[model samples]
Target: MAGRVAAVDCGTNSIRLLIADLVDGRLVEVDRRMTIVRLGQGVDASGAFAPEALERVFAAASDFAAVIRAAGVGRMRFVATSAARDVSNREVFRNGIEERVGIRPEIISGEEEAELSFRGATTSLDLPAPYLVTDIGGGSTELVLGDAGGVIAAESLDIGSVRLTERHVTTDPTSAVELAAITRDIDVLLDKTRVPLDEARAVVAVAGTATTVAAVALNLPEYDRDAVHRARLTADQLRDTTTWLTTSTRAARAAVHSIHPGRVDVIGAGALILQRLVDRLSVDSVLVSEHDILDGVALSLG
Candidate 1:
């Protein structure tokens, strides 16, 4: 059997929509898009979704509704992570989305998010056993370890781009004091995560942060998903990129060809998180994967 399906992933920094045709168990991509709505803005400080943040996400959801309807998707799954899970006024956020998209968003747990991310990211790669998939988002980072059998261990930490930026970054490129604070926060979370970082044979970095880092590491003129997918980013490459990002001004970072304008403010923190993971794991490089939780959500529809 075959069907058209849509998967929506709403995170703190952005909201993405993926529409695909599942033909006899294979997924064929039809449409993929993302909007930077900053939905998690102020959530870390306020413990609730800000009114403007809610509006931005609602607007994005409305646009996704149009895309879904036009694509004639038979089934759709909408998920909200990190920020949605922490907000106290989540019902308000849910109502707006349900009214616009006609589907109530599931605020999934960190463990479930890790599993979905693992399935979406690693199923097609011919990598070694016991792959470590790290998805760094705006509000949290998911670390999942698994092989062909399934997920072995998973953990989600509060260290993320947007959260880190809000918590520690105040200067344009992030002062040394800010960077050190962010590093401490990440180290604490890493210590709490149960997975053995040194044991994994390979690391697969997914989501916007990793992809963007790859695009820069490759020195691509612009964002290219095909080129970045499965691209190897060496420890030196990551360290160099982190140094460039952390020392660059906001305007300078935004000027980078592949750096998204929305991400410029928080990418310094994001890069640091990724860099620390690489150093802690002692891996030579990380293989970037564009397919992540969105793909996993689509597969779950079947």
Candidate 2:
């Protein structure tokens, strides 16, 4: 654990960390953990971090600070994305985190976010042709089209499950009216963004949303990347899974044999986002990645 550099991703929905020691050509993971902090709950409406959201982030970061210290990790690279970069109160949150977590979270631009996600996604796969990379986070989703060497086109969408669920879908089952509005918005983005799916040989999805869905497909009791990563999922199966998830309450979803307890509440929105992407692109199957932006950050820093 000596000379380990820790990379922390303070995302709108989750705070993730990767402790690694570079070994020749590969990155070896020493420790990793994700905490659901929902830091962007109403930032889209209020144009600032909500009071409760700020509190959740501070409380969680304090704990992460302790873990980092316990692991004997000294050098750290921390970045915040989406909601943090969008809202004006980023400094306020950043000040609090530096005071409590002993680290000032750097706000990474959308381009950097897409790059890290792409780095994590493509490096984990063996792509035959260029692919469209999709990452669904809590506050934002990134859609990137790229080749083997670098990114070609990438855009970050403000539409995330947490934001969508808070703004539109209120009912336990998420009524059809709300669902329609969200779908219309997403469909329009897909059309307007002009992402070329016809040329893409495949689609790859990274981050918690895609990996969690893959886990459910494989019926894993715990989230295991070895089983979940690169798990092939179809558009039909994606739709079917989302339909099944929407029927249950948060408690019921958590009670399901496959779903993670911390992921149950927000997963409905994640599934919807994934399903829409799959449908719009006419994607028959997609590759899932357990590693995401955090892993890419570690790689980049090396």
Candidate 3:
């Protein structure tokens, strides 16, 4: 079956939209875009969406609405994660989107977010199982283990790039003290994943953090989805990248042709999370996938 659909993923740090055409069971991207709104800027401590965050998200929604309309999408779905889930004033966030886009955003559970990420990252690859899919977002991280039959186990951790950076890193070129604190927080959550990490034959990492890290590891002149997708980043590469990110100034990270301006401040924490996961899992390499929950959200529309 073939159809046209639009999918929107609103996370703590960014709002992304994917409009694609499903042709003979394959997804062809029509217009995939992202805007950093830092929706979860202070949600970790406040437990509410900041007024600025809400306005930024709504503005992006307004822009996405136009893109979605122009594409003539047959169906559309919006999935909000992490920051949206913990916020106390969700009604305001909900009403804003509903009014701007004419469609309400569904704040998905961590379990659901994990499943969708697994489905999207592994569907197009002929990788061995059980593949551990990791999606490091701004406010949380999702770990999903699955085989060809489908998801077998999934867990979401409360640690994320934005959350940890905001909580721990208070200075430019984060100090060792801050990095250590972030590491402790991540390690605690990683230990909580009762699923046997050793069972997975290979690992696949998805989302902005992973892709950005991959782009830097490859030393690409710029960010390219085709190059980053299915890219295998070795343990050494992860370690090296993490070191550079942790030790570099914010300007240095932002100067990287591959690093997005919005991710400059928090990418160091994100790299730490990925490196720790790689070290914890004892995997030789992690395969990066560009298709993640956003793609999975679009597929669900069919």
Candidate 4:
């Protein structure tokens, strides 16, 4: 209860674990883990968890729990986001987690997920008041508006990297026709999120897509928390990157200088969503934050 805290965010696309020790009010990370399990791979169409997907997620959870235990984490909590919230077999997965990993994950609402994302992005920021936060994840994109260090309004849209890719980009190369449909769909989601966009001073982007774009912008070969945690991207950069990703095949995208190899497949839809949001909102720049729900969960415990 007094040494360290661990939080795992089990998402549709990835499983992320953060274990940190709080010393003099500062959190020092003891262990961090990320695995792409794609638990909700085809849930958009099938409306049920695929067998492989379920197995992968459960295995990831089992590994994460072992890591936390090995690290001797003092306190911990696990939460599942959009994917778990939307799935009908959520209880089955939750029950399985308890049996397999000795941990029962809490399925958080979209609004709650957005709020946690907001906390992770801005809690450490020295930004101007009234910031906008958005986390474009696997199955949902969370948008939030807040003043200073606290959230004011937040909402989660059903558009995410996996969902968009599965729903629109059916072709191996994602033909222009498919790309156009994804663009149009993302434009609509942006329209709905504009309510929060209009109220904030600057946009703070978190989660995989946002951070992956920032990683690309910095031209880093691998993820660098220090380099990307507060990396900034302009409107032009966002638009250009979106265009570049949409034009390249998955292999070609993987060969890019900074893009992560695992992220290549879904980056196209993710970038387009980010680009449309920035363009439609007329925002000049966006800052990317690597800390997301895990960071929020760790801090809230104190």
* TM-score to true structure, per model: 0.98, 0.93, 0.98, 0.94
Candidate 2, residue 297: the lDDT equals 82
The lDDT values for all models are: 0.92, 0.80, 0.92, 0.82
- Model 1, TM vs. native: 0.98
lDDT of 4 by residue, 1-302 (tens): 34698888888798899999866555688887799899888989888788899999888888887787888887787888888878778888899778865768889999888888877777668876678888888898888889774778888898889999989877768898998898888878777664567666788888889888887766787778789888899888887777877887777787775666667788888888788777756468998888788888887666
Model 2, residue 302: what's the lDDT? 64
Local error of candidate 3 at 145, Å? 0.6
> In candidate 3, residue 240 scores what lDDT?
96
Question: What is the clash count of model 1?
Answer: 0
**Sequence-dependent TM-score of model 4:** 0.94
Candidate 3 residue-wise lDDT, 35-79, digit = tens: 999999999988998998898999999999999999899989999
Please report how far candidate 4 places residue 134 from its true position, in Å: 0.6
RMSD of 2: 2.1
Clash-forming residue pairs, model 3: none
- Give the root-mean-square deviation of each candidate in angstroms: 0.9, 2.1, 0.9, 1.7
Q: Write the residue-wise lDDT of candidate 1 on 1-302 in tens digits.
A: 68999999999999999999988766899999999999999989999999999999999999999989999999999999999999999999999999999999999999999999998998668888788999999999999999999999999998899999998877876788888899999998897789888788899999999999888888999999999998998899999998998889999888888998889898888999999898988578899999999999998888
Kindly list the per-residue Cα lDDT of model 2 for residues 1-302, writing each as its tens digit: 23566888988788888888755535788998888888987877888898898998888888888888888875788899998987887889989999987878889987789888888778857776778888898888888889887888888888777777777777877678877877776677767665575667788989888888888766687677789878888877777888777656777677765666667777887888888888766458888888788888877766
Looking at model 4, which ten-residue stretch has the lowest summed lDDT?
Answer: 192-201
What TM-score does candidate 2 reach? 0.93
